[model samples]
Every structure is written in C-alpha cells, then in structure tokens.
Target: TRRHRCRTSASQCSFCEEYILWFSIAQDILKYISPRDEIKLPELELPNINELKQQQLKQQQQLLQQQQQQTLLQSARSSSKPKFTIEMSSGGDNQSTSSSLSLNNEEEVPANMNTIAPVPAAAVAAASTTPELKVENNPDAGIWITSQGVFYFKLNTLHIHLQFFYSVLKELDRIIDIDALYYLLCCLKLLILNDECLETAAKDNRGFLSYCLEKLLVPHIWKIFALGHGHLNECCVPLLLHALNYEPGKTALWNILERDFSSAHWKVRSSAGTRVIALYSLLKPKLIKNNYNVLSVLAYAFLNLITSIEDVEPTVSQKAMCSLETLGDASFKTVMCALEFQFDTVINDRSIILHRLSKLYTILLRNNSTIKILSWEFFLNRFDTLSIESQISMEESGELISPQSIGGFNTESEHFIRKLNQIRFAMAKTDSIKPISSSIRVPSHQRRTTTTVPRQTNVTSDKVETDSIGSFLSPETENSDRSTLQLLVNLLMKFMMKDDQNQVNDDRIMLKQQVTSNI
Candidate 1:
C-alpha cells in the first residue's frame, strides 16, 4: 500500500453545513417571533350614496330658491326705476361709445356670476362625496369596515399561521430531540415577550392559550424538570406568569401548582412551595376583591403550605416554612383561618397537631390588635374536653401517669401549654373587658359543630367525668402534661403485645427444628 494524504477540510464537512443551516433557521424563527408594528386608523364612516344625493338636491333647491329671490328683487327694482337717454356728439363717436357701453355692461354682470357661484357649491359637495363612494366600491382600497364600527386595513401575515404555532406548542411534548425542544421553547418565549403577540395568541382561539397552559405547557415543563432539565424551567416561568392575565389560565396555573405541591418528589414540592409564594404576591390585590374562586385557591394553597411544613425532606420543609412566613407577613387573617381550618380537620399525628396549634397561638400573641377573646376561649374549652377524654381512656386502661412513663415527654408541647396558660391567665385578668368580635371569619365549609363521642358508662360516672374536666385552667393544663403520657402508654402496650407474640412464634419454630433433628 502506498501512503496518501487526505486533502479534505473540516469546514467542508456535512455536519458543519447542517450546523450552519440550523443556526440560520433559529435566527429566522427569532425574527419571526418578534412583533411587527401595526398601524391602526380611526374608523371612518362613509357617506351613504343616497344621503349624499339628497344633500346635493337640497343644496340645488336652495340655490334655485335664492336665484328666484334675486330675480324677483331685480325685476322689482328695474320696474321701480325710470328710463333716461342722452344725445351722442357724432355717428362714429356714437358707435365707439355704444361698443364701450356694451363692454361696461358685460363687465358689470355680477348678478349672473353670483347665481353661477352657488351651482359650484353643489358640484363641490358632489365631488367630495364621490371619492368616498368610490372607496367603498373599490376592492383594491385595502380598507375593511365591520358592523361593529372597527376598521381593518390589512391582516398580518403572522396571524394567518397563529394556529400552526399554537398546534406546535400543544404538541411540544412529542418532540424528543433536546436541541429542537430548546429551540422551540426559546422561540415561544420570544413570542411571549411581545405583548401584542400574546394578545393575538389569546384572541386567536378561545381557551386555546389556557388549554396549552394547563395541558401542555405546565405538564411538559414539569416533565422537563423531572428529567433534570431545570434550565428549561426558567424559560417557562415567564410564560406561566404571563398566562395569569387570562382567567382560565389563572385557574389552570393554580391547579397545576396545587398538584405539584403534592408530588412525591421533594424537589417538585420545594419548587411548588416557592411558586405558591410568588403567586400569592401576584394575586394579593385580587384577594382583596373577595373573589370566591381566588379565596378558595388561596385557602387550598395555605393548606398545602401547612402540610409541606411537616415534610420529611428538609429542603421542602424549609421552603414551606419560609412560604408560610411570607404569607403571614402579607395577610395574617388568611393564615389564621387556614390554621383554624387545619385544626378542625382530622390529623393523626399529635405532634403535628400541637405544632400547628402552637403556631396559631404564637400568631395570636403577636397580633397587637384586639381579637375575639371568645375564639381563644372556645379553643381552650375544646382542649379541655380532649384532655378529659384522654384521661378517661388512660384511667380505663389502668396506665399510670408519670413523666418517666411517657418516655421523657415532648418539652415543646409543655412549653406551648405554659404559653396557653399565660393566655388564659391574661383573659382571666381582663374579665371586666368585653370580648371584641373577631375580624377574621372562617369560611362556611370550614365550620363544623364540635360533637363529643359519648363513652359507654353509667350515668353517674359520665356526670363525674364531665364535672371533673369542666374547669379550663386545671383540667387543660393537667391534660396537657399527661396527653403525651397517655399516647406513649398506648403505643408501649401495643409494642409489648407484639413482642410477646413474636417470641412465642420463635419458640414454636425452635421446638419444631429440634423435633426434626431427632427424627
């Protein structure tokens, strides 16, 4: 074999050509996404042909009437005048003077000229009206007038292909290529950067923008995030925020956010928590308008945030805590309602329940404004009832109540109870002051009657249980100390029974093995 050198260069490669073509297409797409200036003209009402003709006829009639009046006046004046004549000097002079007099009479013909002047006014009106009629009749004039009194000069070329763009956005998920998807998203973002383009896209088809947002944009962007393409999320956030301008889009965006908040992935939950805070900031003004839908969404968001605060993942929990703080700073009344609503619902975890109640109490204490003392008193009464029920269950089970028995009970709950006692003490001290009505009102759906489950017992025992737990300060504080103790005792009893069963099963298995060895 003979040694040979290749003469081909990298610039001439097919891949290089493809890259250049791609770049050119990308540039063209960007240029296409940019909005072109549209010229809007004021609506011009065209003069009706029949109306113009009537106006001309009226002008002509008026001119004729004036001419008749002038003729009558001229005839009357001429009849009122006497005719006079003078002798000429010679025949030739008389002929010259007669020609000169005829020229002067022709020059003094202003009366006929005045009558002719009004005729052109009619002609002028007709001339002015003709162009408008011709404009109305002509096809090439490029002006269109709708019955709504709007004038359309010309259609934008981009508008013709808007549906195609929307379809592409709708089908964005079907695109598998990363570069292609990124390019498409970039182009879409550029399109959204132009307010006019967004308006046109919204008006192009009813609910199309919202459908794309709810079904396409949100899910796809979240999918990309799930696939580890976080940078794409940045590109999509602006589009999502802009979608808030549409009513359907607003609802759709909120639904997606609510769904994502409950996602199994911690990262998704964290992102949703942050987005919720941002959305609340954006919608704070609308919340003031008392829109029922908006308030409902806000209530849901608050509930999600509260749940996320107890998330196992630190990242998500921290985000939720920060979000709650942000919301509290913005509107305390809304947060208060959400807390109360959560408390009213079924929560299995005693620690989480106490944590939320403590948070609510903290909020109430921080609030300097006079709130309904009765609401606080009502909660205290409920706590007193729960404490009594737990004590009755504990006594029925014959479990001893002690600090050591509860496995070194939660100091946080004790401290929270101490704070609650302080509040109660303050209320007692202010017995003379009338309770102010609460400015915050919980929604109807959140309201429920507190009904106690009656325990099976003799009438005298039931009466004694009720009487023993009736006092707010002594029973609630005592129950607060022993509530955790009661919970631990139950769990311990269940664990002991489970361990005994397990040991018995193991012993039976060992005996079977020994019998098999002997055989």
Candidate 2:
C-alpha cells in the first residue's frame, strides 16, 4: 500500500510541472492586453493534468522511435557508396596464399539480399592473380545493326579504317574464290555509293576514300573496262564513276579516262569519249580559271579525243567530235596548235582535216570576236602559201572577207553585237565589270602567231576573175562577212568600169593595192 501511494505522488508531481508551464504561457499572453479595456475574462478550466501526463509520455516514446528509424535510414545510404575491400586468406596443401576481390556492391548485390552466394575459394584464388577485366567503351557501338548485320560508320575514325580497308583490298587479287571476290566488289559498290554513306556521313572523308579507290579499286575497274562484254563494267565502273562526282574522286576518274581511251574494246573507247563530254558539260568557268593545274593534267586526256576524231570507227570519231564541240572556242586554240605540229604527217588525211578545221573555225568566229579577229589575221598572213584555186575558192566562199565591213555588220554580226551590248548593259546595271569584258579572257599565248607570206605578183587574170563558192557558211548564219565584203568589191568593180583609160590604169593600181591591203 505504501509503494502504490508513492507512485501516485510521482505522477501528481509530473502533472504539476506541466500545469506550471501552461500557467506561464497564459501570463505572457495577458501581458499584451490594455489595462483600461473593460473586457470580460472567460472561466478557465484545465484538463485533468494527471491523465494528460500519460498521453504526453506515450507521444515522447513514439518520437524517440521515429528518430531511431531516421538514423537507420542514414546508415543505409552510407553503405550504398562505393565499397573497397581487401581480404587475405592462408591455404593448406603446403601452400600459403593471399587473395582479394573488390566487388561493386551497387551492381553485384543480389536482389534477395539474404540469399547472396559465397564466392568459391578456387575462384577467389584465381581472381587474385588475374588482371582486372576492363570494360572498354566503344564510341562506335551505337551504330551496330543486328538484323542486317552491318555497321554504319559515324566517321570518327574513318581515315584509320580506310587505311586498313585499303591494305586488305590489296590482298583481294590473291583471293582464290572468284565468287567471293565478286561478292566483295558488289558489297563495296553498295557501301561506297549509298547516298547517306557517301554524301552525309562520309562526306568529309572523301579524300581518303578517293585515294583508297584510286590505289586499290582502280586497277580492277580498268580490268572491267577492258573486258567490256561482262557485267563487271556495268557494276564496277558506275560505282567508281559515281565516286568521281565528288572532288576527291576526280583523280580516279581521270585515271580511268587516261588508261581506257585506248582500250581494245571499241565500246570502252566510245564510252570514254562520252564520259569526257559529260565532264566538260558540267564545268563552271570558276573551276576552269581557278583549278588550272588539275585542268592542265586533265587536258592530257583530251588528246585521245583529238586523235579519235579521225578514227576509222564513225561511232567513236563522232563521239570525239561531240566532246570537242562542247569545248567551244577553247578547243579552237588546241586543235590549231595540234594541226601546226602534225600538219606534215597528216597530209593523207588533209580533206578530213580541212573539213574539221572549217567546222571549228565557223563555230569560233560565230561566238568569240577575239577568235574571229585572230583567225582572220592568221588566214590573211598565210594567203600566198595557199593555191590559186584555193584562194579563189576562199574569196567566193567569203572566208577571206575584209574587216572594213564590220561597221556595216551583217545579221550574224548584228546578233553578235547584240549579245555584246547585252553583256555591257548588264555590267553597267550592276556596276560590276566581272560579267562581260573579262569573263572568257583568252590567254596571251593563244593569240595569233605571226606568219610572213611573200607578195603574190605572179597571178593569172583568170585566177582573179573566177570565184568558185566555197562551203563556209551554214544556213543559220546567212548574212556572213563574205556577203558584206562582196558588196564592197562589187562597188569597186563598177567604179573601174566607169573610169577613162589613163585614170583607169591609176585607179586600177589603187584598187589592187586596196584589195591586197584588205586581204
């Protein structure tokens, strides 16, 4: 009974302490009120303090439990950080051993934490001497395609891969399996020509790819060109041709033309001509002016076109002419140079040469005033060297027309003047001189080379009188300089007919001098 009374007194003492705390809080609040206010105070009733003491004790215990749980959670987070471990073990069988393995707990921990299996002693022993198994990260790993079994390159190491590829490609010639080799070629076609592969991912690596193709693939490609009857030409040449569209592959393209234009297969030779034509068709003037060295080297390939122009095969020669014609007046200078060098050797083919010369001359005179003036200077300087029959023919044909007629220009000359005027007007409008005056400036070396012809005094009157028309003008260019020059000559003829004998002799001599000067 005495012990129970002591416990009740202890409980009462706890409630007294809580009551004191509440009474102090009430006093602090009343201090904020005004003393003069007539406010009525409500009757204060405190809860049974002894019972409240028990509830407060229970809440205190629950808070302490929550604090303990929080500490446990913090401890769990610390364990999750990287763990490093070192273990040493001694073994029996007359051998002493020490072994260790660092486990990344984050990855190695089992899902059922309680069920983690122990590492075998043998495994641990082996692991101690073994090097750390490194996992290398492949930058290109993302490009692997499993279904098609191909790797699309991201081009990070494209040059290195191409070097290795070219090395392997060099060994393909030794491969005994023809079928496998052919299949490899087909695979290369697809890999190198894929639009995304060529123009997108590998665009910057074009130079390396082009070099590889030239050094390794081009020899085999030439074989295909020579074999003309096979599917190889259709398959492989086109692949290399497509590559040539890019700047880097132009070397391989040029090599193909250089090597194959003389190919035994007529079809291959004709195809070479066609390719040259196509290449020149796409030429921009900027490229012609800026890339002079490359164009000079490429010009070596055009000699094949020149010789082929006289080839026995009409089909082949026609293709060559078509290409030469595309070069416009630029070809005029080249062909004239060639003719000057090879004229003696080509005497047997003179008619054919003359025909081609006439075509080129007419083409140039129609488009370029510089070539027109230069060619006229050249023909006049060489007049005496030509036969009398040839001279008369030229006069009738209007090929040797005088320059005085330029002011009273014909329809063709009028068209040319109109074009020149348009160019000048365009330049004036833009206030830029780059368009017309200097666009196709001829090189100084291509200007007319001076030739001296002795005066033609030993002439027959019949030779001067007979003017057999030559085939110089095409129907499209009807109002040629010839017609204009003829009109001038006709006026001189009537002037001679009306003059008296003494005046006739003087006027005739003057007329001859005028005609000679014009020529």
Candidate 3:
C-alpha cells in the first residue's frame, strides 16, 4: 500500500541510460534497404584492406582531381589551361589506384604535368585510351555499357566497376545459392527492362538486345524448364512477354512461351498463364495469331493447374487472379469464343469455379490500367457467361458452385455489380461516348493507351505495354467497353427468391431438441 509513497521521484528511478529502441529502429530501417539485396554489386570479397585501399585511392584521386580542376580554373583564369591531369598511387602489394574525374572541366587536360600531379599509372593508361561509351539521352544503353565495360576490361576493379547490366544476370545465375535466383531474376529483369542504359544500348547497338536475350534469357529457358521445380521469377515471363511485343520478332519470345506453356513447374506454369494474356494482347493489336492449338492446351493447363491447388498461398492465388483478369482484353474475348464451347467440359468443378469466382471478384475489385484487362477480365465482365456455364454444371448434378465460406452469393453478386459499373463508368469517361443502349460496350480497344505497368499498379490486372517499337492497335478491344452496366436483374431476383425451407426445418428441429432437453 505504501509502495507508491515510498517510491523515489520520477528521475530518481533506477533506469539504464540506453537508446536500444533508436538503435534497433535504425537497424530495421537499414534492413529494409540493405545493400546486400542489390544484384549489381558483387559480394565483398576483400577484407577491410580492400575497403581501406579503395578509400585511400579515392582520397588520392579526389586530391588529384581537385588539383587538376584547380589548375583548369587557374588556367582559364590565366593564359594556359590545356593540360588535364589526374593522379594514381600504388596500393597493397603493388595494386595500382586510378583517379577518375567524372565531371572535370571541358578544357583539354594534358596527361603529363609535374605542377599538376602524377597520374596513377593505370589512370594514365586509361586516360591515354578511348573514353568510356557515352549514351545520349538513353539510360538503357548507359546501363548496358557500364555493365559491359567492367566485363570487357577484365580490370576486376570493384569500386569503379562497370554497370554490367546484362552480364550481371549471368553472374547472378551462377552465384545465387538457392531459389533466391527467382527473386534475383525478378529484380534484375525489372531493373534491366526499364533501365535507361539498356534501352540506350539497344538503340545504339541495334543487335545488342538480341545478343543479350540470347546470352541471358534464351540459353536458360531450357534449364528453367528442365528444373521443373515451379520456381520462376514472376517478372521473368512478363518481361519476356514485353520483349515479344516490344519488337515482335526482335527476340525469340515464341520459344519462351512454348517452353513455359509446357513447363511442369507450377510457378513456371502460372507465368505461362500471364504470358498467354500478353501473347493475345500483343497479337490483338497486330492481328497476329499465335498457334491456337498451343493456346488451347495452355488454357486447359492453366485452368486445371489453377483448380488443382486445394490450398493455395495468397501470392499464387492473387497472381493467378491477375493473370486471368489480364486475359480480359478484347483479344481474349476473341479467344474466349473459341474457348466457350469447351468451358462446360473443361471447367466443371464447382469448388474450382467458386475459387475462380472469388479470385475474379478480387481482381475486379482492384482493377485499373495496370491490370491490363486480360482474358480473366473478359470472363469476369462477362459473368453472365460464367453463370450460364455454372447452371450447366448444376443441371448436370455436378455440385453447384459454392463460395468456400469467403462470402455469400448476395455479397459477391453485389460486388460484381459494382465492379461492372466501374468498368462502364471508366469507359464512358475515357471514350467520351455514351452508350446508345445501356448494355452495349463502347467501340473496343480503339485508342488503347500505351503505358506499361507502374508502381502502385496494384490494380488487379496491371497493364502491359510496349515502347519504342512498332505500334499495334486492336479494334475488338473497343468492344469490351460495351460489356457495361451493373447487376443482372434476373440474377439478383433469383438470389432474392432462392428457396430456403431447409433452413426453417433445421431451426424447428433445433427448437424441438431444446424443448425435449429442458423437459
């Protein structure tokens, strides 16, 4: 009772003078962006000696550059500013240090000058040679060249190393110890695909992209397929799909597609699913028809594989939904026509259909440009077709579609209705064309925008787009805007009037049991 009264004043309490929270929080923040995650940088093979050497060399170079720049300004301020000078020194065990001034002044600096400073011999060698490749307003090329320069020079200089964009991929494949390869590939493909240097390199060297594809992606396709462990970078297939559409025949996209479609690995299989969307979307614009037979096989494979997983991880489920929604483009509608006849036979499982429904609902719930309305979007927007197909299953006495306790049909139907309206409203706003009839979708895929997926493209079907390539536009895509409006009145009425006398009977039985127990 007297403990509080006897307690010392607030500042007098025994407390350790520690800032663990701040330190721990700082550690966590660093963990979020730990440099170890980057694929471009090689592992630190050197000890503190290597690091110190680098630091010393950096300091020396800085000093030399300052002297040279100081010389340049002095000369510019004076009569003579011709000699551009840099410095280098020897490191541990005769390791030479080179100082490079990246932003040196424009005046021609000579290689030799005592008043300036001694050029690190290696620095002098590089200065005596050609300048590094310069990319003009192109990041991809710069990335590619920086990457290439390191490998080309065989200098093994880690700090001032090349960007090594393409070849870094090959190194990653060799070095990554585990399934990290997939994630690494994902990071790198995303990096390289969007890199300004790689793009510039591709533009500057017309054949460089193909060379990279052949070296980095093409050779590994078979190994990726052969491993069949279902481990693949989610970005890998889509990036390839991007390449396929980017220049069409510039790279061997068809090969990657064929391989992924046939791959036994579920991860690879799922990638194939999205790639199918990419293929159709890509072909839709050009009216280029890929092999329907292979496409058909992929469809069955995708559905069967999708349905087979009794308990799917959330990421897989989410990605599968995305892949499906992306399939919704007008091109997919064209493809689905051929697929509709087979739906009853191919997709009869009630549980799978429900699962598909749940996933479709999720995708539509999150729809935007990034989730490029692939065939799945086509299927969801055309839920009427799905319901018709479901009715066939019910009639066949093959277990009616049941949502696995995720939500009730009424809620789902309403969600579906709301999403459909969004699609319609979005179309109305985008097309500036009101529907002649409430049910009609707008002229489809006319004037489709050409921006690829973006950050926060969490929209279910993230958009897929191509750049700096031949433009292929679609006509049928415009038809999709017409698949408008909200809940189907008849369907809602059916749900409202659904027979549920079994529930009453069950309740009566429960009441009787309760009375008997009380007696």
Error of 1 at 121 (Å): 65
Candidate 2 per-residue lDDT, tens place, 87-137, comes to: 222344223221122333443455325312333334444544667922222
Give the runs in model 3 whose Cα sits over 4 Å from its true position: 1-163, 179-183, 186-190, 218-232, 248-251, 259-519
lDDT per residue (tens digit) for residues 1-519 in model 1: 122222474334454445445744864766575665422211222233345557778989999999999889778766764333233334577775776676557646864354211223244445447975232311123232211121223234236555445555664666554555666676666666543455665675333344455556656664654443545556664565455444555456555755676576777777776665554443323233322233434455555655565566777776666555544344555444433332322122233334443443344345432322113223433354344344434543565352111112232465334323322322222221111111112233222233111121122232333333333224434543344334323323333433345545654575455434433
User: Which segments of model 2 are wrong by more than 4 Å?
Assistant: 1-156, 159-168, 175-178, 195-197, 200-207, 259-306, 309-519
lDDT of 2: 0.40
Worst 10 residues of 1 by lDDT: 431-440
Models, CA RMSD each: 29.7, 40.3, 25.7
Q: What is the lDDT of candidate 3?
A: 0.37
Supply candidate 3's per-residue lDDT for 345: 24
The model with the greatest lDDT is 1
Query: Taking the tens digit of each residue's C-alpha lDDT, what string does model 3 give over 1-519?
Result: 012221554543232112223334533453354344322311111123334557778989999999999888777655653233322333332332122232243333443333222223344346446567222223333322222221122213212112354544555446322334554554455454434334554565433454455556544543553343444534344444334332322224444544554444557656555544444443332232332222333334334333322213344446555555545455544444333322322222222333333334344545632232222223333454333333333433555443111111232454434433333333223222211122111122211233222111323222323221102112333122111111222222322343446644654575455434433
Candidate 3: lDDT of 209?
52
Rate residue 378 of model 3 by lDDT. 32
